[model samples]
Target chain A: MNIQTKSQFVAVASITSELSAVMVVAKEISLAAANAKAIAFRAGDKAKGFQPITDFINELAKETIDLVTNINVYALSLYRLTVNEYRRTVAYNKFDLVVKTTEGVTYAQSMQAPLENAKISMQNCQRQFKRDVKQLLDQLEAVMHHARAARVIAANSRIEASQAGEYLQSLQAVAESVDKAAHTIHDNVQRCRIALSLYRNS
Target chain B: MKMTKIYEGSYQWIMFGRDANKPSNIIDSNQYAVRTANRCLLLEPGGSELFAPMMAAVLHHTPVDQITDLFASHQDPDVISSLGLWDQALSNAKLHAPAIWEGYLRHFGCESIEYVPIPDNGGTIKLDSVELQLIPAHYLHSPGNFHVYDHHAKILMSGDVGSAVEAPGAPMYVDNFDSHIEKMRYFHQRWMPSNQAKRAWIERVRNLDIDILAPQHGRVFKGDDVKRFLDWFDSLQVGIAV
Candidate 1:
């Protein structure tokens, strides 16, 4: 295998590793949202604003989890495509070598068809890989969008947490956890995007 | 790659080996092709490294499309690892390999070609008018191995039974039977894992009237050397590693 082909395989495989961390953090955010919702109920009128923010946090976490789950499946398919592409490329190169070796021999011209077919099969796999990478990048971008919205929700959660008297500390802790989870999700998804960006259809 | 025509009547049996450009690390192997009027069958098509030169050599005799059949003696890489490349090149070819090794051999890539599984007892591969018998040589080296014998041509394509580890550019046929004993002794003793299997295979092969014994590796044995190899192999104790 060539250096570029090796890199392409590594880049595709790394996305799965990075996104598993994002899945875990997204679930953590979901758990934090449940804790905040209970605290808001106990604070009654003081946490009225915080109750709705908790629902928004839960909704964002669910969306992020769902998006990451789908992207994981897509990443697995991309890895298979990389393997298929490598096989096609090897077959094509070997067929080309056969053509060169049989220069002056009789029936050498019969190899031209397989050679042409191999080239076309290899090119098709290359094009398919680029298209799939572009789609995966777009999906990663969606996860990034959710992470950004989560940070915004965390800020609103902090402002609402200040109003509750006795429940203030617990509510602030919930807000802190959400903010940390959002940062993790953002960083992991960003890494996935960066790794896959090289092979994008652009 | 050197090409030698061992048999020529209505159909031809051509042996390919002794590749001058083969890499130094891998052991050398011989590939045989049986060409009839409209079709060709490649026996022990060789490893992935030998695919290019082997194909180039075969193209001198037959085209890619007409190369319709492939046979693997066992699941060994040196025997049939080039299967994936052949699968892609020949769209309509059928691989006649051992029935027990169908799943294991598919790991080498066999999507396009149809796999004709040879039963434990043995089977026959008919290419147009010529009919070649698949003789069971199980546990000769591999547990589910086989050899090809042509009744009409009186040639037996032994898998590894009469094989020797010779140096590069070695002569195709065994020039002197007695001097060749040392070259084949260690390989057969170490690699052939069953004394019972060896005895059974020797007994079965003695029944056939073989004029030429073509092994996958090393030299070919013709005329009286065919009987000489069998006598030498019969007395030698194998499965010595245990």
Candidate 2:
């Protein structure tokens, strides 16, 4: 009920509402990417649907930043490290997903043989998008946890919140771990795409 | 009063009334409360200039649920004067106090807020982490005046019995008794000059191990000062038991 809690809740509700939109956009981009890959598999020649997915993914990234800023404003700073780490991972992964999906379409346009193989590569890129979205959702969950704990801290000092501080620290550690894991995946994929680009041109 | 870090969570001690530093005209003794619980509680919130400040502070502590409990030590306007504003913000918190003081709570246009009368003797309220016990203060200041006993903090927030005339910025705790004894005596003579009432309340206080003494008008007395104040009050006689 305190001002901090009230303000934080309003921001949380805003984030939740905004997340619905993000999810919808992400789903559209995924479907678009899938459709583009499906066309390349059938005809081995279309690259038009690919650009829309990349453009939409770009918009999603911008929206993601706006969401993070809102979270930071209402944030408790308890999970600052976790949020920052996840932010990096999500940003990197989203960037990788966009680059890879775009490259898969380019790969199809330039290559003549193994058309189905190019579609498979594009499908893998879409999977990367899904992975990044999951990471973002995980980060949002951690932020919500800290927000709730901060609310308890604001409402009354009588609460035993030192324990909650420990929990928040653990949340950061987990986020860092997830970030590192995702970073490795992202980097390996980026290098593979570079090699694939070198092999197939358009 | 030197506002100490008695306790604050996500809720900060926010003041919402106008010129809250000034002695309240609505209530003779001006004191403001910072409400941070899921359900904020207003103490002596009044219609005077203090109304807006109390609302702002309460608003800071209150979100969707509104005020949980509207509380006052007695029926005095200074204590329950702002009941009107609180009733509007958190219609469900309800106005609660002794039956005798019920009229004053209702006096603030009892449309939205529910009025609950505590037995003349006492009542217990369970807040989120703390429990509030209301003990009758009898005639120390008003008929319905009662001390709010916070068990966790070991504090007894008496209405006017402990207000001092020294600088308004007087310390709540008395690390040095001799330093504040004069001011304490001066205040007791003017405000709580009833020997019988003092004796009765002293016994009531003695039954509990009080760590702090938070008077409505002055600073809270903590640690040794709390014990010493009681001993001093025990020795004094006020106006032939009148």
Candidate 3:
């Protein structure tokens, strides 16, 4: 395999690794949302605004979790396609060598069909890989959107926690955890997008 | 790659080996092709490294589309690792390999070609008018191995039974059996894993009237050298590593 092909394999494989971390952080956000809801209930009227924010936080986490789960499956299929592409490329090169070596032979022209067919198969795999990467990028963009919305929810959470009196410390801690989890999800998804963007429609 | 016409009548048996451009690291192997009027069968089509030169040599006799059949003696990489390339090249070919090795050999990539699994007892591959017998040579080196024998051509394409390790550009046929003993002795003793399997294989091949004993590697044995190889192999103790 050449350097570019090796890089392509590594890029496709790294998607799964990066996304698993995103999944864990999203679940942590879900747990943080539940803890905030309990503190909001204890503060009663003081944390009324924070109760709705907790639901939003849980909803964003669920959506991010679902998106990452689907992307992981797509990434696995992309890896398989990469393997198929490599095999087809190798076959095409070897067939081309045969054509060159057998130039003066009697039945040399007969290899044209297989050669043409291999080239087409290899091209198909490349095109399919690019199309899949584009779709995966779009899905990752959706996760990034959820991460940004989460940051906004964390800011609103801090404002509401100031009015909760005795429950203020617990609510503020929940807000901080959500903000940190969102930042992690944002960074992990950004890495996946960067790694996959190279092959998209190229 | 050197091409030798070992048999010619209604059909032809051409051996391909001694590739001048082959990499130094890998062991050399021989590939054989049986070409009839309309169809061709490639026996022990060789490793992935030899695919290019082997295919180039084969085009001298038949076209890619007419290359309809492939046979693997066992699941060894040196024997049939080029299977993935062949699977892509020949759209209508059938691979006649051991029944036990279908799952294992598919790892080499065999999607397009039909796999004709040879049962443990043995089977036959009929290419147009010529019929070649798949003689069981299990545990010869691989647990599920076989050899091809042409009744009409009187040649046995032995998998590794009569094999030797000769240097590059070695002659196609064994010139002298006595001097060739040392080259084959260590390989057979170390690789062939069963004395009982060796005895059974010798007894089975003794019944066939073979004029030429062909192997996947090293030199071919013709005329009296065929019997001489059998006699030498019969007395030698194998599976010595245990």
Candidate 4:
């Protein structure tokens, strides 16, 4: 059975590992893009050069890192906030309605930054490009295409936020799971309130 | 404290890697001061806290001017980023190193130190009693990396090879060979890095007849365990399932 706490810890660690790799990749890519920028600025009507080739490869690596980091950070945040809301109900032994609502609300808020960053990086694919050259321009164009795709996927972050409301359907559905314990609902609410304040204030 | 085993070379010994238990602590990296009778050499002592934490360990006896050559095994932050920082500490420190990672040292701003290039075609240098053999072990961890050996001590500073991600109070040397081999076996199974690159370097290491293998990460490998670790390292495919 997938308990909430175990699921959250695994999610966080996985996100951290993915972020670490992306950070390394981003640095590699940044180096490449910087080198390519230096070369394209100085190509001087000469042949297509190895100097820019270094940059292009580095940029490719960075772009890969950027996409991974953005999504993971955002997703992990939502998961953290959403589940923290329910920690009280599990404690008071009230596996009922109110606890389910707030968790769903928290899950939706965590993805804001990653979704935004993905859009910004995709835009950089064009902003960082040099115009009018066939070879380098074509390569940048390909990079820009992928960046756009990332932005499109991140557009769904808001939709995920909207789904948060529906997940809190404990108003109608809570009576089914905890119906036998419905008589104790008043006691658990007070317990839930005290626990939630301790958590929120922290 | 146990007797400090002094390596006869000029090592700056900049420390790096997973260092720091407290919130406001310097990074966890150590610089090696490899000394010889006539001269002293400094190895990669990472940049962040090289002077405060690392030099505090060295400066109790000697000053920076005594250091002549600076050597970095590779371009890792835990390995060599402090080349520039060490140069700033010593006025006349020259960098003696492999050619592969020279650009990175320069990138870290080690312009004051003169670059001593090692010829890959094969060469040897004697710093008095200690004979230094520059064995190029590229891609065992990263590209352009090499390991330094002292035939006198029968020790090969193996860089990142033969490493284990052990915690504090971990054994430095094992008395029982079998249990030690298991540590190394598990270590290499997960972290040998690049296979194609390690194969060629393993061949070079086989010919060296080393006694002690001192890697940067975890415990140093010695005796029959050294051979066992090498054999285990050789048999496994590069990269770990874990």
Candidate 5:
């Protein structure tokens, strides 16, 4: 169960971890593309058309992974902000309880100023958390946009492979693999977007 | 941050360095903490860039409030630039540094800490029941440097005395002395000015029964390796300006 204070943070953290899994997929796609390129190089002129498709797939995987990793950095900021907010809230609550319980005491009268200051500090933390979360969501959306761009690149690679005729029968497998990995990255980022959207609404 | 226990007694001496997470742009530096039952003393706790992670690492061993004192070797940013953050975090903690660097280090934002100036010859810091000596390490590299020597633990926190420029995530202790020479050679020759100062430091330290020669940048020299380092350092000519 997600605590109300950390619900958005928990959601963002999960999205960040999910993005890590997508990076693994990207790495595998990169490896497969490299293998395909090696085979194309060995075939020489026979598989000349297939080499460019492999290069495109490899480039797409690298770009997707880089963008997702960048988004994870913003997610980390949200995590830190959330932790700070939780700490500030705890401090404020502790001071509030003390002020309420010690009403009419001289020390309590003096503590009121600091207690009000703590409240203001906590309010500021909440405001910062909201602002950072919005920024993180925008960054995550950008990552999703990049993932979609990778999918388009993959689609183009597949189209290029199909155009190679009988000479690039082996290239079709590599193209399909790139397409699958691209779909996985795009779909994973979409899921992360949905998760962040749920937190934003909540 | 990887922490290793060099000495174990009623008062323990722990070395905190070889941090893989530290920013690459900054030079790698070591942080040592001496922990007693009641109080803790952090020695040369590195720069402002490392304050958060280093404190997080320190919490693994001792509580923040228990950190009664902070000892900086000199006014180097890599040595105690994080003094300000530590000042804010550890209330009632006093900073024990060389008297010469007292005014200079105040620029690092040490407003809260009651700075106790160590004299030129050096002084003793008694944390509860443990007494550690702040031995004079004048200009091995820094102008006004002091190293911590835990008498009971037989561990000398020799700041930059046996420092090396090894890769991040290198082993904590020197396993092979011969191979480690290359790492420390250039560092000592270039950074350490004055061969006379080097000879003076070596002569002073020779009398101490240092089982573990822990430095601020690289690996700790334990057992026979301590003598090997001392002998090797004595032979090496320093302050050769090209």
Candidate 6:
């Protein structure tokens, strides 16, 4: 493979791997969100103030999962497009040898009746690939947005858990776990965006 | 694809193809490369399907970037289907083919290589130190065709001109000229398309001093077989298809 193709492959692989990491974080935060809800329910009247924060955290976890799901779908498309383009590059290299063989003048050099159509098609596919990459970034950004909001809700839940004397330790532990998961999800999303910037020149 | 050294010295000629791994459906093709110290010229590198194996075979001999020139006798799929892939691999290489098929072959996605168009009259290329002739062999099959000639080796890389439609796993060179006629006769008759053009090409090639008449398909013709082929081809009526 050419250097350009190698670099592009590495970039795409990095983004996909980071997105998978984000999925794991989302899943963990969702479990923590559920646990926070259970704790709030058990605390009954004492944890009334904590109920709203846990509800908000639960909603944000679901939103993050939904956005990440969409991001994964778009990333899969991006991977396929990138692989197709690389194959095109490889095919182009092999056929070039026919012309290199003669080392003379070619008759119908510019006459690309079929190639013209293929070029247009390839350009369209490339445009779609770019648009898909942008859409994936948008989705990642949306997930990150929710992750940040969840972190804020988790902080509030921790404060409210401390106020509820009965289930202070369990409520604070779930809140702490939710906060860490959200932070991890946010960091992974940022990594994905950086990885995607490698395609800017494309 | 396999690369076998046909000649070795100050310059070299390596034959690639007749790949066992090639799909059963596609016609088998032979690809050749002429390598000098500073440059290597690839001849009729074959279709896109042959690209990976052919490159693997070539890489076993030389680095991909060392290939500086590409030559296609015509626009047939078996002749030049791998143009796009080569374009990606050898960005510094240039393609030389008949001027008539320039626009047509470009459809194979030739974006990088600079095209040095060959006129109908034919021309010469300097491969580092060796000067090779692009002898015109138009209408042997395609409307525009060429054959590469190496005077030092006295070898004629006859594109489709002396090609034979042999079955799979056939020998690389003709050992019996009489039996080989069966493999070549129908292909020349139906594909050559113009008896007048055939005779003209035959008359021109007859004057050249060739020890090995190497064609794109079937086998190479050597020594007496060269003269035997010319005499036989001259008498036969081609372009018989209506």
- Ranking by lDDT, best first? 3, 1, 6, 5, 2, 4
B94: Cα error in model 2, Å: 1.3
TM-score of each: 0.97, 0.48, 0.98, 0.47, 0.56, 0.60
Expressed as tens digits, the lDDT of each residue in A117-164 for candidate 3 is: 999999999999999999999999999999999999999999999988
Question: What clash pairs does model 1 have?
Answer: none
Fnat of candidate 3 is: 0.90
Clashing pairs in 5: none
Candidate 3 error regions (>4 Å): none
**Residue B55's lDDT in candidate 3:** 96
Worst 10 residues of 5 chain A by lDDT: A105-114
**TM-score, cand. 3:** 0.98
lDDT of 5 at B192: 90
Put down candidate 6 lDDT per residue, B74-165, tens digits, no spaces.
89989997888777667589999999999999888688888778999999988989999999998888888889998888889998877898
* Model 6 ranges with Cα > 4 A deviation: A1-128, A132-202
> What is the docking quality class of candidate 6?
incorrect
Q: Candidate 5 at residue A168, lDDT?
A: 55
- Each candidate's lDDT (Cα)? 0.94, 0.50, 0.95, 0.49, 0.79, 0.80
**Candidate 2 docking quality: incorrect, acceptable, medium or high:** incorrect
Candidate 3 clash pair list = none
lDDT digits (tens) for residues B38-130 of candidate 2: 555555565433544433333333442535666677776666665654443343666667777676567655666778788878897656655
Q: State the local distance difference test value for candidate 5.
A: 0.79
- What are the TM values for chain B, all candidates? 0.99, 0.81, 0.99, 0.79, 0.97, 0.98
TM-score of 6: 0.60
Superposed model 5: Cα runs more than 4 Å off: A1-202
| Candidate 4, B-chain TM | 0.79
